[model samples]
Target: MAFSAAESKLVSIFCQSVLYGVYVVLFTATTYTLLWGNKARRSVRRHNMLFVSFLIFVIATMHMATNFSRIVLAFIIHADAPGGPAAFFNELSNFTQMFGSTLYVFQTLLGDALVLYRSYLVWERKLWIVAFPCLLLLGSTATGIGILYAFDKVVPLADVFVVQLGHWITAFFSMTFTTNVICTSLVAYRIWTLNHRRKHGDSMRRHALRPALLLIVESGACYSATLLALLILYNVDSWFQYVVLDSVSPIVGIVFSVIMLRIASGVSTEEGETALLGESGVVNSGGGGVQLSVLDADPDQKTVAV
Candidate 1:
């Protein structure tokens, strides 16, 4: 059956509501992490935590503001009233759709940057490895801005219209999707490779932090899956696209915030702990990623004094 206008509105609102619910809960966790997790860390760690919290808060506030705008627009231009659908759609085409989506796009970009940074660190700060994602990020940013600009110039349409500027929108999301996939895969691979290098006791080493890598990998996977879903939904030419898009910022913020929170709380494996404590210099496995010790089959190379 074809989705009714009311049904489309409901889907967007319901998804928005649920995602905001996730945001509120994450903000609560973020508050706790800020209060307790930064107690003993170096100034840099504390500062980094503050920065992450600030970014996540910005994203949450932006999503909330955009949703409020939509609600107000819906009330003002009741789609079911006489000539209401035309007025409502025209307003959307002229303003609300682009404005609201711009906030969503920026939020996604911030999330993408976070993962890319992590991947860069994971790869021992290998500039060449991160070059492509950084370029894609820049392209995504430019295209997103272009889309917003185009949205304003286009005359309002009588019906919900997507196809005219759809290719540009698709390009932005595709770049975003690819960037997330690459970063997530690199970070996860680095962690898995680190663990795989050891024949045993990765579980027992600095037991407090062992779960951190797992958390990072799992969160990366979850967010990557969401990006893939959003890309697919966007291509479907339905209102359901926003259903996925609206939820994205909060999801990305929550996933990355949780990882940072855990890290702040000192949940790290031995190598991570080594990096955190400055025991060994920049082994990729240590989470420092600046200087990497060459891995070898020999026992001596494996035992580089930490």
Candidate 2:
């Protein structure tokens, strides 16, 4: 299982190269979204905004840590002579891996939160809609972590197998796909119901549904691609898996940035305003912000001061 000096150096270089590429793409996309999108300037739904931002930071940190580890590994592998520096690099790599695992948990949690938040928006007060998903995600994440800890410092084979399975179900495939599907279906159903109930041609209904549709489609595509990549990696060896999985974060980050930007840009039309805010004052519309009260309410009817 030992690599020759030249082979080790080559592998290290390749890993560093792939990691660097991921870092660059993710940083670029995140930076673009932050700069061009008015997410920071405008008010938004507290939960959605906070969760999305948190996810972005976690993904960024994960990539940075992975890249740093690869750089250290490269240095260790390519060192002309082995000494204190090699030992330091090895230790640093292990530290990065440990921290990376923790970040991965945060990443999964954030994704689940995003889905739960969407479900909350869709089925307001049907608390179970959000609660069930949150509970499932929490259980999945906890189980993954427990499995990894069960085989702590023991060559990582068991940990990797358990984690990879968890990722396939929770992180890469099921959570994203299934959640998006339910949310999208609910949003579409709401749209259809609104359209059917309207007396006249409701332009507003269409406008309001646009953003939700866009989000659903974009998220669906992104998750689908990520899942495909995961499937491909599952059939590959360790080296290929490392390269492919390492490439995933940057792509996910980019997709997130794009979706957030679209949200920040405001996808709803004037006709869609009513669709955005349900009869109950909750905004069922896409993206952040909730309507607590109708802006067009009669002033004379509600003169009571708060």
Candidate 3:
């Protein structure tokens, strides 16, 4: 489908405006949830509070970078009247694009780290849990270097691959989605086997697996929506639809914050102790009174909710 010059200009303006609006909303929600949310301060939750906080900051940065990029593009398009201001804006846009690309690499790796951490918790493995984050760091650094090199060497290829194909690939094959499914499947298999063994009896193991189950399902749903959007609408000029997808991260962030807050606020005694150790994390009190903790917590640690 081809767009007339006027139509293309209108679409661009609409996209830029929507991006700016979502940018404001996302930054506000992220700041409030991290800084002043009651659940955010709890000491007993199992999720990595520091990592979550860091993720929030990264999301904010992403939004800000996008917003600045949009503003620069808008200025360049409408800069019929020339001045030093237009030249400065052009330079600023170039810088933001570089920074934004770097941050996107970090975001991808961070998602992978979270997935690995969650998987380790399910398997009750100490080694995998420790190794995954280190692996992610190395992977991120290498990917960042590769992206920089590609960006510098092949302009057309980088624009198509990095700018367009990157989002398309990630929307479907993101580390978060892949890991969540794998971990959840493993957990489900275990739950099924436990249930089979207890065909004529009751098992507490089923209860212990509930939180992981819920998290897996939720992550799957969010990723599914994102994937659908990418598949069906990403290349289309449906500003409204793209905005919906763009807004997904912040909305997911808020939902996660709320659920986490609830869990943090109601940690059990054993779980609280576990939280302090920094090994196994605690989900809030619920589901047949099962208290789950990991074994890899550092003995010197305190303040476990994340």
lDDT score for residue 293 of model 1: 30
Best prediction by lDDT: 1
RMSD (CA, Å), each prediction? 6.8, 9.8, 10.2
For all candidates in order, the CA lDDT equals: 0.64, 0.46, 0.43
Q: Please, what is the TM-score per model? A: 0.77, 0.54, 0.50
Q: Looking at model 2, report the run of 10 residues with the lowest lDDT sum.
A: 297-306
Tens digits of per-residue lDDT for model 2 on 187-236? 44543453234232243344465535443443334544554565455543
Tens-digit lDDT track of model 1 for 163-231: 656777788889988998888777776665664455434333544354454645433767888888877
* Winner by TM-score between candidate 3 and candidate 2: 2
Candidate 3 lDDT tens digits, 1-306: 654322333454455445446544654554455456565454444346546755755674575557456455645664554542233223322555456545545554554455445445544555654464455445555655565455445443122234534443344334334444454454444333422332212222334454344434323345435535543443454333334443444444443443344334333121111111124544222233444344222335321222
Residue 195 lDDT (model 1): 43
Count of backbone collisions in candidate 2: 4
